[model samples]
Structure formats: C-alpha cells, structure tokens
Target: MYADPRRRPVTFFVGERVYLMMLMWKGVIWFGKRGKLAPRYIGPFSIGQLLNDQTVVLDLPAELFGIHDTFNVCYIHKCKVDDESQILSLQDLKVDMSKKLLEGPIRIVHRKVI
Candidate 1:
C-alpha cells in the first residue's frame, strides 16, 4: 500500500455517528454531479454494529432506502462536531437529486475588465 506502516490506523466503534464517503459510479448524478465540487461525505448516520475494526453496520435514513447500510472503514469517517462546526438546517440550502446545491440566484454586483 502507499501508506506508511508507522502511521496510526483508522478506527471506529458501534453507536458512533459517521459520514459515509460517496463512492461507486452510479452515473454522473450520484458520483460526479458537481465534478470536483461534490461533497465527499454524505451522512452522520449512527453505527448499528461493528462487524470488525474495518466494517460497521449503519442506521441509514429513509432517503437511502435502496442503498446498503453496512460499509467499510475506508468508506466512513468519524464526525466530530465542535464549536466551530456550523449547524445547517435543511431550509438553509436547496439540493436536488443531481447533488447540485443552490444557495440563491446569481447576480452581478459589479463587472470589471483588465
């Protein structure tokens, strides 16, 4: 592997909430909707059980009804919400199936040419 043996290993436990990395090629809508601007992690879903140090079962929401809940450690990351973590409500942003985020309409406040 490209990783160093001296580095600490990634770990997770049962009952911990984590964000699942969006992988797999399910067309542009799921994987490359925004090209490189797409968010890497999807949810802070709670872990139902730890199958091992490398995999865990997640309590996925209804939104992901068709997708599997069990995921590998490489596909999940621990979500640590600190004081600097801003709480965003669903009403704050508009997201479509294509994963396109719409903050608001685009307006040209000023224009300049060099």
Candidate 2:
C-alpha cells in the first residue's frame, strides 16, 4: 500500500529510442574513468525486442558487444527530442593542455559587500 503511490508503470515499444543506464567498474577503461562528472547513462539506442513486460533488448552498437544487450525497464529512460539551445559546442570552450578551462568569467553577474 505504501509503495503503490510511488510506483509508476514504464512501457517501451520496439524501434523506440531510449537511454541506457551505465555502470562503472574498477579497471574498466572502456567506459573511461569514473568520477563525479562521469556520465550516468549513454546512448539513445533503438529497442530491438521485448523479452518480457519488464525486460528489453536494445540494438546497441558494435563497440558495446562485450556488454549484454538485455536490460530491465528500470535502467531505461525514453529519449526526448533534442533541444537545440541546450546543446553546447566544444569549440566555444577554451581549455589548456591539461583540459582545464583557460578562460575565466567575462564579468561577475552578482556581487555582495556583506
């Protein structure tokens, strides 16, 4: 009874695009280093098949061949259309050899004397 309100049904259809939750493992360089800024999910892959009501098979790329294609619905999220304004271009960013931002803020947006 307590969990009913918090629980929501999730559904997916074949050919629909969705994001898959990514798991980090020690010594797995394929997914890159895990850190505070590491990506939590990857891909907007198409649904290849439905194994059951709660399980799905994704059409993952060849690079992800090592990982199982099947995933539980809990680990999948529907992909929404991309927002143009929300996208950032890498060319606009200025980084040094170490990949740290080389430029500071152009102007302070707020300042307090207190």
Candidate 3:
C-alpha cells in the first residue's frame, strides 16, 4: 500500500506482522522511550467508522485489523524528517481537519516473547 506521497511501505514477508491504520482526528507527538510497561498498541486504522455524539462506532474487527480495538497516537513516530504536509508532529499537535492525518508508527520494544 501507499504510505502517502513521500514515504513508501516497508517490505514484509508472509510471517511478518502489520497493523491496519488510517488518520486520526487528533494530533499527537511521540518521544523516544526507555521504560518498559503497558501493551504496545499500534495503528490509526485503514478504515474509520463514522463517529457520533450519542454513541461511538468503531471499525469492524475482521474487516480491519482485529488484533487491537483502539490505538494510542504516540505508538508511531517519524524516524526521518521531510517537508511538512500540514501534518501534526508531536512537537506541534492540533486538532484540525485541513491538516493531513496519518497512522501511528509500528514499534517493537523490549517485551517477553510469546
């Protein structure tokens, strides 16, 4: 799949793991971490469900990545810097529509091997 107009998707094998993601409505910035705690959730979802004020709707588990129901914005970070595309960086986060939305980065931290 295309990773926007600039970045390309990393090569993956059949056994490789990937998370389904899309753009988020909110802005988030991430800093390199050293502590080891909590589950490592990923993605912004490829398909997003229409949100409502009364109740919250979510993307389908099977249709989307069924592994995780929700994700934290900080899970993904840009390793390299490029000309900004109206996207929100952790350094500068704002909840606006005109700005481009993107998925959280896939990260592997020191955790017990299952």
Candidate 4:
C-alpha cells in the first residue's frame, strides 16, 4: 500500500516530501503518521515529478539526498483503501496490490501525459 509514505518504494529515503509510489505488491497503504513503521514499497522520489512533470514521472526525489537506511516490509499501519485493488488512492480504489505486483496482469494508466 502507498500514500502511507511508509510502504516500500521502487526507491526512497527519510525526511522527504510527498511520494509517488509505483506499487509492486498487493496490500494496503499505511502511513507512519501514527508513529508506526513498515517496509518501503515503491520509492522516495522528490516531489519534483508531481510538481514539474505533469504526468508524475519520477526517478528519485531530490530531497532523498542524505538518507540511506532502507528496509523491507515487516510492520505497518493499514489505511482506509482496500488492498484488493491495483491502485492506491485516497478515494474508492479497490484492488489487490500484492497479487497484481507479483502477477503479470497489471498495466499502469495515468490521468495525464508526461
């Protein structure tokens, strides 16, 4: 699960701003706001992609500069979004991220072009 900012990213770091995680597993989005921690899922890219690139094409966020320590999932705080969907959003997104990311039946579709 993404949006949680705690879920693993394809890449990430500490003290960074918002993240645009590309999910590779099926699960729930859990943020560390509640003083909880989990393995990262996607990445720690800077807010640049979401800020400059209209399509949210992120490689790595500039703010992810000084942090290093990264880990895989072990502990986490579940979010409101269901983990049975392909997308993780604050809205009504339903899909299995764990299954889809491991499976080959997923394709990424965005709302705009980069």
Would you estimate the TM-scores of all the predictions?
Answer: 0.66, 0.67, 0.18, 0.18
User: By TM-score, is 1 or 2 better?
Assistant: 2
**Which candidate should be chosen as best, given lDDT against the real structure?**
2
Candidate 2 wrong stretches, greater than 4 Å: 4-7, 27-30, 82-96, 101-114
Residue 5, candidate 1: Cα error in Å is 3.5
Residue 15 error, candidate 3, Å = 28
Clash count in backbone of candidate 2: 0
On residues 1-114, what C-alpha lDDT tens digit does candidate 1 reach at each position?
998879998777777778888764655236333557656777677899988888789998776677888888888888887532353433456778786776774457688989
Rank by lDDT (best first): 2, 1, 4, 3
**Model 4, C-alpha of 3: deviation from truth (Å):** 19
lDDT of 4 by residue, 12-65 (tens): 223333334323344544432122233253332333332221233234435444
TM-score, candidate 2, is: 0.67
- Per-residue lDDT of model 3, residues 10-88, tens digit only: 4322222234333332333223222352124333223243233222233434634433443332233322324334333
Candidate 1 residues lying further than 4 Å off, grouped into runs, are 27-33, 82-91, 94-114
